[model samples]
Target chain A: MSDTRIIKKRYIFMASVFIGLALLLVILPEKSTSKQLKPEQLLLQINDNNRYVSTDEDARKIIAGDNYMQLIDVRSPGEYVEFHLKGAINIPIDSIFNKDKNGDYVYEDILNQDVKINVFYSNGTVYANQVWILLKRLNYKNNYVMKGGLNRWIETVIRPPKPSVTATVNEVALYNFRKAASMYFGGGSVAVPAEDNAPAPIIKKKPKQEEEGGC
Target chain B: MEEVKIQQNTPRKYMNPYLAGVLLGLVILFSFYLTREGLGASGAFKRGVAKVEQIIIPAHVNSEKSAFYHYVKNGEDPLKNRLVYMIIGVFIGGFLSGAINHRLKLKLEHSPKITSKTRAIAAVIGGAIFGIGSAFGRGCTSGAGLDGMAVLATSGFVVVGMIFGVGYLVAWFFRKLWI
Candidate 1:
């Protein structure tokens, strides 16, 4: 009879604990959770004051006229310097969640922004989407992620000509620039014409006659 | 006899629920402070599922149109991700707490009103539904809803409300399963 009573008491205690956990989950506020937005839903959430444009074309339009939209390149610092969209700021994906030396989340640099729209881009969707989710969790409702990343931009925006298994001088220069920029930035480089207006011309000269070899 | 051992084994007392909750909350805060993100569970499960799918149905894995599958394909080993690492931390945290409280055991907990078989079946069914719901909702209780709420996100609140609201609404029909 005593054992039975003890078992009954234990059961109640466990049940209450589980219920409390479940209740806690239910009651947690929306500020800390990742917002799982479908592509369409996220797009719809973007208003004129908070547009979430993905493509270079839209980015160009926004830069040309709309001063309110803030374009963010969520690639590496090196990638941003190479070739980013026009008027985009570079903030690496790793740095998106960076902590200080004391292991505290750097608050002021990340959350204090009073911007109209915050759009993020990366080499592809993964990093950008991660940033999008992070910002949404931080109560930054006016956030957007660029679709397809800079790879898509190179395909659809830059539209480089198909090479017949050989590189032209211009193509080589572009490729080298991209490689260097990616190294410098992190992944795909951002190339805003206003900032990186001139493609550094490759100075190619015929090799000097090998007089030393002849001698 | 084993059942007797389990019953006689003097179960450990657990931490006060409120204190445990506050500890969990601080863990979450520390995680965000260090990584600028919250804790997660379902992401690991999804990655595990994707890996299994990759092994059993390679063609289907290759053919999926979703970006998530693309990520799996692009040599980004899902198991090595931050979420996976965090889940490892969670297991350690949970086990440590359990061990400290003398709750480490492989026993099936159930209500007095249900048979062990019935409880097992309910557990499986509940898990399946929870898995599907997590996919649609983009995360589970810990990841999307609880952590999302801490940061004050609207979507977090919406999902938490919807999931619990549905759970309560249907709980009446499933009373036998729990009670």
Candidate 2:
């Protein structure tokens, strides 16, 4: 073929290839983890009790220093500064989607990963639930809302009402556990022995086998 | 047979710039899809420098005051990272592409107007300045220009504009080296 003919053929192929890639991108529309669920799918999960990690469980994780449990305080920065659960990382509700200085979504790796169960809490359920719904809609898994937020933590873990004399053995045992937790958190004087309780991991990881090594 | 001899004697024609650009865009898109990270070289180079510092002066890499300490802190090995592997792949791929095009050769490249020694010195100075600029910009051309633009990032567009804009604006001063 002539040089001009060869050049024309190459140009046409390049143009078509470029146009095809553009069309593919448009058609796919962010086929990544951008899995924005339909309202129906989201609604089905909104009422799912499993979305919540109870105050007791949250306290247990905190006390045990569970590596796989990441506590996120989803409140205003001022609220976070005033008080938050021990070891919680504060990501203000509004700034959850904002990227940090390094251009990564603020605490996004924790929100998106499965190795750790990200427990989000605020003053109440509203902010925490908002974060939960937002992350869930974006198809992020392994995130849970702390059922009653800081309010519940305060009520159950910080200052539990003493069990009545008629209370069951289990209720009495739970009260004693909370009493110990209150002391640990500097909210009570009674230094009761903490229960040897660690919340089970949300995700059951497969036992890691040793790698057979060779370069 | 005659055409084949001529082809062997000359470098192959370069790929069309538009086609190469589109391919690079696709590569960046796929990299994001698979790794959830941009394809950048400078960050990896930074990590490599951090590793070298650790090897040469272990104390310096561990010191909090040292800039490279960030990469080598807490017993973390930056050399074991994915970005480092990507850079290694880039070197091998570049060589392979050059060989395929019959452009593979080890020789000093200098403009006719400039001596080879001058070219070498200018390259070293230019590279050092570019390295400093990349550090300040948080990325080099490949990272900020191609990958950033691929994602429609504002920083990426700004970097690319600054690179060419500044290059053209200052080219007059460097014209003697080329012309």
Candidate 3:
């Protein structure tokens, strides 16, 4: 074939490929059929809405016998077996979408439930946050993340700290609430020493050094 | 025969770079508006790799431990991914552009100073390094540099700066290949 003819053939081939791809894009099923939230809108929701539950708030809800609230432990099965919040159901993050012998999603029934609230917690906020986002994308309603996850739960509930004497009224009140929550959860709480009334020391951070130029 | 000769000899001029850039920006904006995400190039490569891995070791591709498994686990065709489709469109658009400009000749592009073999070797090395870098960076130039910069992301600025800085720094050593 001549040079121009070959070029024309190549151009026609490319055009055909382009048309084929465009058709495929239009015909193929989407990854998700549900109306999914945009990343920007998701970010806005995360920042604007109260998506996190404080350890105190979680403890209060659990202790108050709130049947409408569901606590989902999103950690590994081994981690969940070791110790988890009372009345919390273990749903390892990996197996959230496992298929049963009947070819139905294992958590389909649970996820489809019309619960008032479903609080997901993991070792930290990362895993829970991931699960939350996934559930949100699936159009699951009333999903929340346990702020700071089990780490914060251990710090605030398992070891309630006593406020210093010089602490503000709000700080002291919050400490008291935490103490009460600790007692309800059967966690140990230390008494505030009268002699230890000094204000907490404020440490000044060193200035960050400028980054070196060039990669 | 005379008309054919005239047509073959006449090559159209290329579009202005500024206009091309503006058009590219608009395309990126429209992509973001439609999909809630910007354009990406390396993701198509990753999906391609995952598809290849799946074909080679089906069990390994389905294993929970495999990082690539997620791409194919949803029963979705890897080639059908949005990025893969975008890449196909890119190839087609590039070829069409070259054809329109009468610049679609099949030949290796290299400076006269370097042999085609040397250029080929350099290209392979450069592509391999770029693939690894893109994997680490979580994106390629089109995805991270252009799309991220279009959104005014901090990482975008940093990556683009690093790319040009490193390119300039190493250009002198490989001056013979191009200059």
DockQ, per-model, please?
A: 0.01, 0.02, 0.02
- Candidate 2: lDDT of B134? 85
After superposition, the stretches of candidate 3 with alpha carbons farther than 4 Å from their true spots are A1-215, B1-6, B63-67, B74-76
| Interface RMSD, in order shown | 26.6, 11.7, 10.0
- Which is the better candidate, 1 or 3, if ranked by lDDT? 3
Which residue runs does candidate 1 get wrong by more than 4 Å? A1-215, B1-9
TM-score of each: 0.46, 0.60, 0.48
Q: Please give, for residues B31-99, the per-residue lDDT of candidate 3 as tens digits.
A: 889986788888888888878888888788788876666677767566776888888888999899887
Could you tell me the lDDT of residue A107 within candidate 3?
75
Model 2: per-residue Cα lDDT over B66-125, one tens digit each? 776667768889687777788888999999998777888889988898999999999999
> Would you list the rank order by lDDT, best first?
2, 3, 1
Weakest 10 consecutive residues, lDDT, candidate 3 chain B? B10-19
Native contact fraction per model: 0.00, 0.00, 0.00
Off-target runs (Cα >4 Å) in candidate 2 are A1-52, A57-177, A180-215, B6-8
lDDT of 2 by residue, A80-194 (tens): 6666677777778898789888976765666787578789998889999999999988878889999998788888998999999999999999999998988788775223323
TM-score pick, better of 2 and 3: 2
lDDT at position B146, candidate 3 = 84
Ranking by TM-score: 2, 3, 1
